[model samples]
Target: MEENAIRNKYQELGVEGFYTQYGADYSNPHEAQIRQLLLQNQDRIDYNKVLDFCCGSGEVSRTLIEAGYGHVFASDPFTYEAYQKNCGRECWQYTFEDVIRTPIPEQFSAVICSFAMHLCPDEQLFPLVYQLFQSTSQLVIITPHKRPELEQLEGVQLAFEDFCLTAKGKQVRLKAYTSTFTY
Candidate 1:
């Protein structure tokens, strides 16, 4: 979906029910892998405010908050209320067009986005990456599909696979990457 079309749709239709669709604790599956990756790179991340960009339903944010991490935020075009009720942290809901129109919030210690990067429009990908880089020095991106383009960026320091558990007791392989780019 194009940026404007999604924004228009959300404006007219309102945010959809989340629990009935994506469930509440949907972030658990990726927890172990995320923890492992963080632990492996603890020396780099400054443990400052973390933003889970494209955090659908705020599962990741809720998990982090529950784990006692402070200063965490989430952002997505929809799922604002779900994130509020589930994570209890502040979140910004912005469409691609909205992001393009307005500048992303300033600096973050780390920006973690899981399972949603592939949904980004082709034209918006570069800008989104640039935005992320500008907003944070540490970037963690996990996508279910291949995004070789991200590897070509200037300062992606790490790339690995994260096996996220599925509802069916299976594991879904996701491409996990870390971009330690400043600016």
Candidate 2:
């Protein structure tokens, strides 16, 4: 499958291994920091029916739930097992192949794609993005700045970046871009 090819490529590279090696906190940026950023903008966004796309181990979903976001749907092409191991939340709707092949059946309050877009190959990037965009009114992306993967997408806008400083004081920019998607 297409997702498996990407997964295998990630495994060959160090992306998946690094994520698995250091767990959630060491994945360049942690998810809780993004949650704090989203919480600050909570007045504008609905906290219900959120989709955590490319949800590696559901760390971000757990963080969102802790921050009072209800109905968080965690989806990934390869990490739901890890998610079950990590948080074990009872929402039973996603599988490894769901994100790529299965269409998003309905609009969500917001769709959150963190760190995954950069991993997507050029051929798959736009359609995946369009699918995400078509499935939600707002798409929140927390990605590295200067991601060429997103350079040419037609239907999204940059909202604001929350540059998080680690304990070591290193700057990790979570570029939270937004867009209104209507089907």
State which candidate has the highest TM-score. 2
> Against the correct fold, how does model 2 do in TM-score?
0.70
After superposing all C-alphas onto the true structure, candidate 1 shows an RMSD in angstroms of 6.6
Q: What are the per-residue Cα lDDT tens digits for candidate 2 across 24-131?
A: 332223555566656666775565888887777775687777877768887664565676677676434443235446668877888877656676667766667667
Cα lDDT of model 1 by residue, 16-61, tens digit: 4332344333343455555544445445555568888877767556
Judge candidate 2 at residue 15 and give its lDDT.
Answer: 65
- Regions more than 4 Å wrong, model 1: 1-46, 154-183
Off by over 4 Å in 2: 1-29, 90-102, 148-151, 176-183
Deviation of model 2 at 147, angstroms: 1.8
The pairs that clash in candidate 2 are none
